[model samples]
Target: MWLLIAVSVFVGFLIVLYLASPLITPKPLDLKGVHVLVTGGSSGIGKAIAVEVAQRGANICLLARNKAKLEEAQSEIEKVLVDKNQQKVIHISVDISKDYAAVVQAIQQAEEELGPVVLLVNCAGASVAGSFEDLSLNDFKRMIDINYIGTVHVTRAVIPSMKKNQHGRIVFISSQAGQIGLYGYTAYSGSKFALRGLAEALHMELKPYNVYVTLAFPPDTDTPGFAEEQKSKPEETRLISETAGLFQPSVVASSIIKDVVSGRFFSYAGLDGYMLAAVTCGMSPVTSIMEATQQVACMGIFRIISLFYLDHFDRICRKCKQERSDPSSEKKTS
Candidate 1:
């Protein structure tokens, strides 16, 4: 009798949770006729996101430091617009990491051309990988400048307008490295991880104004940036990253867009992404009761699984260290 009573109570609780989900869930944002500004949209995942939103009928503004690449991306995005005659795409050349006044000016130009930005995608970022001791101070500073402060500058410029409008969506394209610190990513991970703190605090301040924030944790992706990152990765970092595998830029962009429209606080790509998001969820805002329940139920199991992953990574680091210390090991293997 007690066992049956316990099961009945649990089922009743789930039913109540499901019915209450809508109260906390934000209405989905429509992309049609909306203005979206994508930083770093001249290439890679940023370009892919611009194409995705263009297909949804949003006017696009691409921001990057390279005027040539921005123009090239602008033309490509225009080709995918749902309304060729009505929809428009424009590009601005500016380094978001530098001068706040310049960022504000660039945003003004975009809003003047396209209208107030309904969505802002903070995708401009940089990565540098090396042992903590080997990395130059400039490397660390550059990563923070491009990945963290750049997002700050752009978001700061847009917030007042968004608040006045009382509706907006923001996306921060942080990497899987942002979720978990790994070998050779001391500088890169620190910068990416800073995004989460900013996103969380900003979400709180903006939620009352109906401005939603989505922080995306994308795994290793096949992009020009990813290719460059690979060149600087240590052997241990490479081995650990290979376990999750590389995803295409389109896939990552699509996932991010889906979450943004739904007003999800955390966005992730792939199985590994789902696991990390759940395990690290910790006090972050939830859009639905279902999401909260899943995190509650699965976090413990995912934490256990992560231990095995950590062990494997530790083994890789030890092996790499051994090979480096004993030069003869390379000859023996050959």
Candidate 2:
């Protein structure tokens, strides 16, 4: 009993010590008159981001699959921008999942119509939630193709232009699933995790040329698509998503734009994010008092604790890498 009390007191003291620890974040980058591209600009988070950027006096090029939705979102963005400074927003309709050439062409056209593209926000991504047994192989392939490959396609398409300009910012809107594996997210989580490796590599490669890449690991937010996701979420998934605050689209838009403009490498929108990020970033040691106090203590009685979800994620990632290495041999004959 004394030992428990002593440990608790020690942990409390440690937290108090680090409570005022300095946070490492970036200085704000200017956005005035900059041309920005937002993939998946039709609805949900992408549309919100477009609005935020427009309000900041930047020219925006909106891209998404749906023509009507893209037009609708474009109107909203322009209206908001006009209220701020009487400026207009450009919109392009392109199917990101297919037609890489067309998407590139549309971007070029937008550059011609609007101005030079300097900021790229890869906000367009999606996932279908389901267990491994129930989900189809084709569905899994599509998830990777859109979530992972789509990021590559858009970023690669814009690199030459950005390199010539010598200044650019790329933000990929990754999810919590990508940060930590979750129940019934085999396909979604696998591709989402791929972004971390991709962004880390690109950050190192692009830093010399004045291009900065930011990967955003946002918790669940209330977008138009939330109702659809709720249909298949399991209890654990639902709980985590809810714990993330179910924030409105506007809040995410505002905060994410702030993060991108400020050149933040990583950001958690609120309190839970701060706690979750600290523990996960140092999972090897979990040296933070936050872990020693409430987290591990809660799971003490479980004699057989397992990082089952984490192991599954690692195995699938190895499988993903093996397939990427020899696409010709691992190529789907189906």
CA-lDDT, candidates in order: 0.92, 0.73
TM-score of 2: 0.75
With a 3 Å backbone cut-off (N, CA, C), the pairs that clash in candidate 1 are none
User: Whole-model lDDT for model 1 versus the true structure?
Assistant: 0.92
- Give the per-residue lDDT of model 2 (tens digit) for 1-334: 9999998997777667467322222346677788889998878888888888887888889888788888888878878773455455878877776778987898789889777688899988887777687778987899888888888888988888888887888898888778777767888889888987888788767766677777777778777666777888654456445545777777878888887776655545676565554445532212234444444554433222235434544555555446667766456733
Residue-pair clashes per candidate = 0, 0
